[model samples]
Target: MKFSLFITGSPTSTKACHSALDFALALMRGGDHSLAGVFFYEDATYIANQFAMPPRDECHIGQEWADFATQYEIPLYVCIAAAIRRGIVNDSEAKRYELDTSNLAKPYQLEGLGTLISLSSESDRIVRFR
Candidate 1:
């Protein structure tokens, strides 16, 4: 199954992010389904943060997703509007533009919602982890 994981919550103190992450992992491990990639949108798009670090004891779900995405080689995309609105830009983006580079995690590209639309067109199942 060509699936796209759409996350719609902030990375910090956001239930949608956590649930989306969990759901993506489950789909990755599912015996009968195939996952294509993960897409972040709205406030949940903030989950694409690479520099997100909390207390040591606390679970770093964002990093977990980074590692998972790297391991699986799945494409993780963030909405450009959302990322900008939330102030999460990467080095490249920061250079091209001026913004914080905390949210553009590796394996995740900052793109427009049109990308998601294309993904939805190609995806067999578009699951919303909100």
Candidate 2:
């Protein structure tokens, strides 16, 4: 089995991101399937930016996502259109979009809808986390 993920809510606003990470990690443990892709759109795009850090006593949701993706080598991606509009862009994309370079550390890719569609075609099922 294969799964495609779509997260629409911000990580800090909901536990959807953490729950999805747990699900994906469990899937990896089974080793019977692959993560086709992870798509974050709408306000969820903020999860890809490291700057979403909350003050002390708050959970580091974005860091949790980055760590999970890095450890599992999952291709965590955010909607390019959504990210750009929300002021999140990499050095390369920033230049392309004529915007300032933003803080997108690693393990996250700013990709287009085509990536999601491709995953949809390749995966056995499309599972939306939130």
Tell me, by TM-score, which candidate is best.
Answer: 2
Model 1 agreement with the true structure over 11-122: per-residue lDDT tens digits: 7756776787777778778867777777888877667666667899987777778788888788888888888777778777787775544457677788888988988899
lDDT, each prediction: 0.78, 0.83
- Candidate 2: tens digits of C-alpha lDDT, residues 2-60: 89888887777777887887888888888899887789888888888867768889767
TM-scores for the candidates: 0.86, 0.88
Task: Give the poorly placed runs of model 1, Cα more than 4 Å off.
Answer: 98-103
Q: List the residue pairs that clash in candidate 1.
A: 8-44, 9-43, 9-44
Q: Candidate 2: which stretches are off by over 4 Å?
A: 97-100
Q: C-alpha displacement of 104 in model 1, angstroms?
A: 2.2
The TM-score that candidate 2 achieves is: 0.88
Worst ten-residue run, lDDT, model 2?
Answer: 97-106
